[model samples]
Target: MSNVGQHLLSGGLSGFASTICLQPLDLLKTRLQQGDGSSGPRFASPTFTCVTIASTSARNLTVFRTARDIVAIQGPRGLWRGTNATLVRNVPGIALYMTALTHARSVMAVSPYFKAVQKYPSGDSRTRQGSVLPTLTMQGNLLSGATTRVAVGFILNPFSVLKARFESSIYAYESLSGGFMSIVRAGPSELFRGFLASSLRDAPYAGLFVVFYEGLKIETYWTSHTTSAGIHSFSAASAGALATIFTHPFDVIKTKVQVRSEARYHGLYKTIRTIMTQRGIAGFFDGVSLRLSRKVFSSAIGWAVYEGMLMLMASA
Candidate 1:
C-alpha cells in the first residue's frame, strides 16, 4: 500500500529467498568460523595461501568434501542445520532494516540541508510525482544503514545465538523451540553473549554495504546513463563483497562467542586476545572467502528481487 509497507514486504520476501538459496553456504561459513585452529571444512588446497585458522593438519578441503562431511555426519538435512533459526533471524531482521532505511531516507529528504540542496537540479525528484524520495547523501546512507542494522541486530541477537550454536558443533538442537528453551534455561543473558561483537560487525558491514551500493548505483546511473536490475544486482554484490572483507574478523569473533558453552572467549576483548594469542591475525579472518561468496550472492539476489518486487507492487 505505502512505500514503507512495500519495503517491509519486499525485504521479507527477498530475505526469505536468499536464505533458502544460500543456507548451505551460511552453514559452512558458521562452522568454519566456529572451528578452533586445528580443524574445519577446507575450501581449497592446503597450499592455496589461505590463512588456516582451523587446523594444524593442513589438509586440502573442497566444497564437495565439506558437503559430504556434513551429509555423512548429519544426513542430507544437515546442510540446513540451522535453517529455522536463520529464517527466524533474517525475515524480521531484513524487514526492519529496509523499513528503517526507508524512514531514514524520508527523514533525510526533509532535512534543512536536503531542502536547501534540493532547490538545485540534483534534488530529489520522486516527490514531484508523489513518489517517495529515495536519494540520500553518502553520510546519510552510512549512518542509516549502520543504525538500522545495529538496532535490528539487538532485537534478533537471541536468534543469532541459537543459529550459531545450531550450526556449530557446540550444540545439536533437536528443533528450534528446543534450542530456544535450552538457551532460556541457560539464562536470558546467555542469548546475548556476543551482542557487542555482533553489533560491531553488523553496523560496519551494513553501513559500508549501503555506502557502497547506493554510491555505486548513483555513480553508474550517471556514468552509464541507464539503469537496470542487472546493474543494481552487480552493485549490491560488489557492496556485499567489500563489506564482508572489512568486517569478517568481527564475524569470526561473534561466532566464537555465540557457539561456545563456556566463557573462554567471554567478552569482545577477551575473544580478540584469545584469537590473536592462539591463531594470530589470520584467525580473525577464518572463512573470509566463503563469507564473501555468501554475502555477495545473497545480497545481490535479495536486493534485486526486493527492488523488482517494489516496482511490481507499485505498478499494480
Candidate 2:
C-alpha cells in the first residue's frame, strides 16, 4: 500500500477505537468542565476536594457510576458527547501532525549539511563515519511538532470551540442555531484561548510519537523479523500511550477553556496556576486512567484501520 493510504487507514481506524475507549471519559470530562458537580453525592468525601469528577466520589459507580448516570439521564445519545467536534478537530490535527513529522524526518536524514558532517576514512567511511544526523533530526522533531500544530489549529480551532459549546449544555446539539451562534458570538480570540500552549503541548508530543513509532517498527522488524499488521498496531498503541503522558496537561487545559470560557483564563500560565492552586497538580491528570484507555484503543485501532484502508485503496 502507498504510504499515504497506510496513514489514512491507520489513523482513521485508531481514531474510532480511541473514541470508543474514551467516550465515557469524554462524557464525564465535558460535564465536569462545565461545572456540573452533580457527582457530589456519590463521593465518600464530603469536602469536594477537587474539580475533576473522579475526585468527588466513586461509590457504586464512582466515575463510572456517574458516567452511567449521565447516560441514563441523557440517554444513549449523551455518551457520545462532543464526539462530532472531536472528529472534526482531530482528523486534520492528526493528519498535520503525522504528515509533517514524516517529512521532517526525511529531510533531516538527507540534508546536505548532515551528509557533509560525516567523519570518514575513504575506505572505512560507511562503518566509521558518524554524522550530525541526530542533532538535525532533533531539530526537525521539535519544529515538526510545533509547526504542524499551528497549521492544524487553523482548521481545528473552530472545532475546539464547537466541542466546548456542544458540551456547555445539552442545549448545544438540541439547538443547532444556538450552538452556532454561541461560537459565533464568542469572538475569534475566545475561540482559541490557549493557542500557543496548545501548540506547545501538541508538537512535542506528536513529534515524539513519530520518533518512537518509527524507531520501534525498525527495531521490531529488524530483531523479530515480524511484518504482521498486528505488530504495527501494537507499536502505534505504545507510541500513543507515551504521547498521552506528555500532552495530557494541555489536553486538560484545552478542555477547560473550550468548555468554560467564562472562567477567565488570560493565558496558559494563569490557567495552569489556577488549576494548581484551586485544584492542585492532580488537576493536570484528571481522568488520566480513562484517557490512557482511550489513547491505546484509538492508536491501536487507528493504526489497523488506516493500514487496512491503505491496502484496500492500493489494491483498488
* Leading candidate by TM-score: 1
Q: Which stretches of candidate 1 lie over 4 Å from their true place?
A: 38-64, 114-133, 225-227
The candidate scoring highest on lDDT is: 1
lDDT of 2 by residue, 119-198 (tens): 22335323211111133344555555556667777656766666655654423354445555665675787666666666
Worst 10 residues of 1 by lDDT: 43-52
> How do all models score by TM-score?
0.85, 0.72
Model 2 RMSD to the real structure? 7.8
| Reference-based lDDT, residue 132, model 2 | 14
How many residue pairs clash in each candidate at the backbone level? 6, 14
Candidate 1 achieves a global lDDT of: 0.75
Error of 2 at 145 (Å): 3.9
